[model samples]
Target: MTLFTGLAAVAHAQGMSVSSSAFADNALLPAIHAGAGDCGGTNTSPPLEWKNLPQATRSVVIKMTDPDGAKGGGVVHWIAYNIPASVLSLPAGAGDKSGDQITVGKNVSGAAAYRGACPPVGDTPHHYVITVTATDLDPGRLPPGLDAAGLAVALAGHTLNGSTIVARYGR
Candidate 1:
C-alpha cells in the first residue's frame, strides 16, 4: 500500500488509482508547451493514449477534471462515455462532439464539452486528472447529458477496471 499527501491524499485513501503517458505525479503539463493553458487555460483537450485494461471490460468511460476548482472542492471539465472497447487513444480536441467512438456529456460550462485547464491566478498548479473506467455493461445504454452522479448510478456494480493519467497546469 502507498499514500499520497495534500489534495490528492483523500483520493488515494479512497482507493482511486492514477497513471499517465504524457505526465506523472508532480509532472508538468506538456500541453503548455503545445500552447494550451492550464485548466480553463485553453479550449483544446489534450491528446491521450491508454492500455492494459481489465479483461472483463465491455465499455470505457473517460472524464477530465480539475480537483481544484471554484468553491466546489472540484469541478468536472469533461465527461465522455460509451467508448467502444477497441478504442485506445484520443487526440487533442477529441473531447468535442466530433470525436470518434465516443460521446461527450455536459461539462461544468453546461455545454456538453471539454473545457481546458484554467486554474485561478497566483494559485499552485492544479491537477487535471483524466480517468478511463472499464465497465461490463453495454455502451449503448448510456444516454447523452448524464451528470457524474447519474453516470455513477448507471454504472452501479458494472465497473470492471479503470486507468488514469494526471497532469499539472498553472501559470
Candidate 2:
C-alpha cells in the first residue's frame, strides 16, 4: 500500500482530522502564505487545528510539503514537532523561527522555520499537503534540528494517527 493510503487508514480508524481556517482543503492559499523573496508575499504559516487524536498520542508533529516541487521529488516547506498533545492548534505564523510548544525542524533550505510556497513562475499550481501526525513519543523525545528525512526516521512506527489538508498555490 502507498504511504498516503496508510496514513488515511490510520486517520479514519482514529477519527482524526486536520483543518485550516485560512483555506479549505483543496482551495487556493492566500498570498500571505507565499514566500517572501521572489514569491513576493509575506511568508506566513496558516493557522491549523487538529481534533480527535488517538488516545496514545503524547505529542504532535506537523509537516507541509509540495509534491510537485524540486522537479517532482518534492520540497519540504515546514517541519515542526515536539508539540505537546494538549495543544490542539497552531496560530498563524506559529511556524516562525521561534514558538511556544513546538520545536522547529529544517526545511529544504536548511532553515529551522517555515518556508512558504514558491513554485516556479508560470508552472501549474502546486499541491501543498499539510499533515498533522499524532505520535506516542513524548513532547521532548526527539532532538531539535531534524530535517524531513531525519524526522521521518525518528517517527517510524511511533505514529498513532495522522490527518492531512491540501492547499494549492502558484506563482
Candidate 3:
C-alpha cells in the first residue's frame, strides 16, 4: 500500500469520534438547541459525545462555527477547550459556563457561553460545524478572551486527531 494510505489508516485508528444524541450529522437541529430570533427555540447548547481517542491525548477542544454567518468570515458559535481527556461527553447546556473542567473561550458575540444557531430570517439553512480535537496541551494552556482563531493557534501542532459533526438550521 502507498505510504499515504497507510498513514490514513493509522490516523483513522487513532482519531476520536464526535457525535450528538440530539441530532445526526447534517441533520436539522431541534428547537431547544436553536436560537430565539423569532424562531422561538431555546438557546441551549446541544449534547455531544466523543470516543476512540489516542491515549496520549491530554485534552480536547470543542469548537462550533457557522461558515454561513459573519459575511463569509464565519461566526463562532462556541470555543470550549481544555476539556480533560477523561470527559467523553458534554450534557446539554454545558456551555452555559458553569463548570471548571473546561475553559470556554470567547465566541463571536464576545461571550464565553455558547451562541446557538440564529441565521437571518428567510435565509437558506446555515450549517453549524461542531469540531472536537484531541490534543496534547495542558488544561490551562489557553488564556482568557481568546477567540476561535487564537484558540486554533494554541491548538496547532498539538492536535492528534479529531472529528466533526455538521448540522443545518435557518429561520
Between prediction 1 and prediction 3, the one with superior lDDT is: 3
lDDT of 3 by residue, 1-171 (tens): 699998987776676689999999999988788775676577788999998888788888898999989777799988888888888999998875636888888879898888888888888999999999989987777777678779877877999888999999977
TM-score, cand. 2 vs. native: 0.91
User: For model 1, where is the 10-residue window of minimal lDDT?
Assistant: 32-41
User: Which lDDT values do the candidates have, in the order given?
Assistant: 0.71, 0.92, 0.85
Model 1's C-alpha root-mean-square deviation from the true structure amounts to 7.8
lDDT of 2 by residue, 1-171 (tens): 699998987766679999999999999998899899889668899899999998788999999999999999999999999999999998899877656689999999999988998999999999999999999999988898999999999999999889999999998
lDDT for model 3 comes to 0.85
Top TM-score: which candidate number?
Answer: 2
How do the residues 34-75 of candidate 1 rate in per-residue lDDT, one tens digit apiece? 224433345766667766666566778888878887754898
Ranking of all predicted structures according to TM-score, beginning with the best and ending with the worst: 2, 3, 1
RMSD values for the candidates in order, in angstroms, are 7.8, 5.9, 3.4
* Residue 81 alpha-carbon offset, candidate 1, angstroms: 0.6
* Stretches > 4 Å off in candidate 3: 1-12
